[model samples]
Target: MAWFILIFSGAVEAVWAAALDKSAGFTRLWPSLIFLVACAISMGGLAWAMRSIPVGTAYA
Candidate 1:
């Protein structure tokens, strides 16, 4: 379950990065919103997983 969460978080990070690039300095409202939401969810999941595992180990 933890591994799944970690992987999902990583996927979200990738999506957020791509969306941010598409946003182009916030010129695109939809992509900007997507990036913000994805990043928030990814960070929240990462924080939850980090509580039980060391940051290095969790990332690895």
Candidate 2:
């Protein structure tokens, strides 16, 4: 479960990057919203995984 969460976090980070790029300096509403939401989910998953996994490993 920790591994899954960690991986999910990583995937969300990637998606978030793409969404941020598409946000057009946050002037675009939908993509900006997606970026913010994805950022929250990614950080939440990272924190959840930290309960079982070390920061370095979870980050990697």
Candidate 3:
């Protein structure tokens, strides 16, 4: 389950990264918000996983 969360988080990171580009410096409000939310969720999940797994292993 933790591994799954980590993988899902990575996917979310990709989504936010693309959305950030699409936002174009916060000019697009909705996309920028979406990117911020996604990034927060992704980082939170990653932080949770790091509690139990080694950073390198979680990344792997």
- What is the C-alpha local distance difference test score of each model? 0.91, 0.94, 0.91
Q: Give me the displacement of residue 41 in model 3, in angstroms.
A: 0.5
Please list the residue runs of candidate 2 whose C-alpha ends up more than 4 Å from where it truly belongs after superposition.
none
* lDDT comparing candidate 3 with the true structure: 0.91
When summed lDDT is taken over every stretch of 10 residues in candidate 3, the lowest stretch is 51-60
List runs of model 1 lying over 4 Å from the truth.
none
Give candidate 3's root-mean-square deviation (CA, Å). 1.1
lDDT of 3 by residue, 27-52 (tens): 99999999999999999999988888
In terms of lDDT, which candidate is strongest? 2
Candidate 1: tens digits of C-alpha lDDT, residues 1-60 = 777788899999999999999999999999999999999999988988888778998876
Candidate 1 Cα deviation (angstroms), residue 54: 1.1
Q: Is candidate 1 or candidate 2 better by TM-score?
A: 2
Clashing residue pairs found in predicted model 3: none
Model 2 shows how many backbone clashes? 0
The best-first sequence of candidates by lDDT reads 2, 3, 1
Worst 10 residues of 2 by lDDT: 51-60
| Count of clashes, each model | 0, 0, 0
